[model samples]
Target: MNRSHELQLLSLEMQNELFRILDFWSKKAIDSEFGGFVGRINAAGEVVPKASKGAVLNTRLLWTFSATYRKTSNELYRTMADRAYDYLLDYFWDKEDGGLFWECDYQGKPINTRKQAYGQGFGVYAFSEYFLATGNKESLAYARELFALLEEKYRDPEFEGYIEALSADWQLMEDMRLSPKDANSPKSMNTHLHILEPYTNLYRAWPNEKLKERILVLIKLFQKRIIDPKTGHFNLFFDRNWTVQSEIVSYGHDIEGAWLLHEAALETDETEVIQSVRQSALKLVEVTSNEGTDTDGSVWYEKEGDQIDKDRHWWVQAEAMVGLMDAWEITNDDWYFQGLQKAWEYIRANLLDTQNGEWFWSVDDQGNPNAKEDKVGFWKCPYHNSRALIELISRINKLKI
Candidate 1:
């Protein structure tokens, strides 16, 4: 078979595999025992009852299934999305506190009540899309509320960026850690990326004037502060005044941001923004090509100086495929298309757990999938991989039509 035909067949097979896993997890992962989804499921498909549930996982579940339902017109997918949406509103959202909680207990109580802007941004992201799917004004209003909260409390009027986290009552907190590895920075690429994400979704539903400007500014923030002009990799952490604060370079985030920044620009519809974003994205594609990719078609997690953690993360590969595909679409380059196909082949060959329903979170340098990462957990859900498959299928289908 020729190369084009080979890629078409491979993408078709990947789409089928992705839908199968989504169907399996949609049925198996729901928390009929408590509510929403069960807190954790290991590599063996064993549920961990004692694990505390996370807002990020549940919100992402709602968004993925909701988007899938819209894409496929599948009632089963819609049902799953509704379940997650109800659970998020009922359990995770802090009605009095004005944003979503960080974590929840097993029985659906608010355990980690701090308002992480990233989590709230995702809440808005999911709910706004849910509004589009179901026309639920309640969802739209809630999404807008979260948007306002982020702007009012987290956004820096003078400094031109969002703060990382706030206490339950909206006070700035001393401990601003998103994950243990992340530094306690007032601003972070992680938070800003997600904030941009939800704002894009909200604009789709509402199209408010202020929202549009904020989104425009966010793209500029990336160009001005986050993205390294020389290398195209985003600086992970930043001080309150937008000074670079971290040395670690996250390959996954670089690739993920490449596509997201493009989307932000495209969705905004400003010619200058799109032009600028297109330029930055091209540079990012080159940087990841040089520094991130391995000879095995996998991308590493990150590097701290000479210390390279060579583990191929599940989400990183998923994002890399989409980003490479985005690059191909933007530049019409054969190399980017080749890179997308190669990444998908690597994912199918190694990252996918055929016995289990989902992917292994990490894989070794030799392409052995890491067995320790849970199949379902606070950090792992159907979002990244499912979105990757949906994106690939849609883009190819659009191309065909």
Candidate 2:
């Protein structure tokens, strides 16, 4: 097939998968007795209604449905977006303290009220998308509110980047871990990367001077503190003084950050920053493509020293596709296009749960899907895969190839 025909075919496949994802979440993931979506669903498609709802999950649901509604003009998607928005406001939003709670009970009551900067970033991201889709001034106001909260509560004036977690009253917490898997540190690249993402999206909706300035700082942070200039991989954990803490390499975050940083620079419309970030993004993508990808085109989960995590995670492969495609767009290189095709092939062949709806958490090095992880949970959501599809479709459509 010609390049145009190939892109058309890929676009069709991506659109179909995007809708399939929306259908699965809309039908299977809703909590009828409670508000918002259920907290957990197993790989077997059974809903765990009693599971504690997470701010990340709910906010991502808000973003997916809101973005889908904007793309398709489907009232079904709009309805889902509305459900997420109401649930977020009524349950997740901390009325007394301000900002969002990290977790809520199955019944929509506050459980873990700690304010995670990562979760707050997602709040801004979801709310801004919601505003864009519906032109709801309330959504825009809420997004702006979250942005202000981040700036006021999370920003470290003594240091450059934002803090990881805070107490219910917005005091700095001793244990600032985002999860048990993460290092207990004052700052994390993951949190900062996510903050940059939502801030960029929020800037697009609002375009306020403060937001623009914050986005520029975040872009510079990626270029300096978070990413290793020599290695091109992000330093996973850090102290308050910007001291690097961990040596782990997360391929997913590396690829995701590449595109995200580029997007942020583009949104800023600063020529110098854009030029610098473009080069940095290319290097990040190159490193990930070289060291992180398996022979079958699947991205490994992470690496620590010589001990490589060969598992092909669902989100990693999803982001790899988008990242590689972004690289292809930037360089007009056939190698990056092939890399994208390979990642998509790996996803379809291994990661996607053809029998059950949605994706597997990950597949092992041998291509066996791990059944232990929750299909839908705090860390697992439709955002990465669905957004990748949305991005790919839009990018491919714009390609003259």
Q: Candidate 2's C-alpha lDDT?
A: 0.91
TM-score, model 1 to reference: 0.97
* Model 1: per-residue Cα lDDT over 1-401, one tens digit each: 77567657866886797788787678779788788889899888899877899989998998898888888888988899899999998998777867888998899898889989899899999999898888889999999999999899889999898999998999989999998978998899999999998899899999999999999999999999999876678999998899999988899999899999999899989998899899998888778878989866678899989999999999999999989989988988989888887888888889888787788888888777777879899999899999888888878766743
Mind giving the per-residue lDDT tens digits that candidate 2 earns over 65-178? Answer: 999899889999999999999999999898888899999989988889999999999999999999999999999999999999999889999988999999999887888899
Global fold similarity of model 2 (TM-score): 0.99
Looking at candidate 2, the ten consecutive residues that score lowest on lDDT are 347-356
Predicted structure 1: clash tally: 0
Candidate lDDT values, in order: 0.88, 0.91
RMSD of each: 1.3, 0.8
Clashes of 2: 0
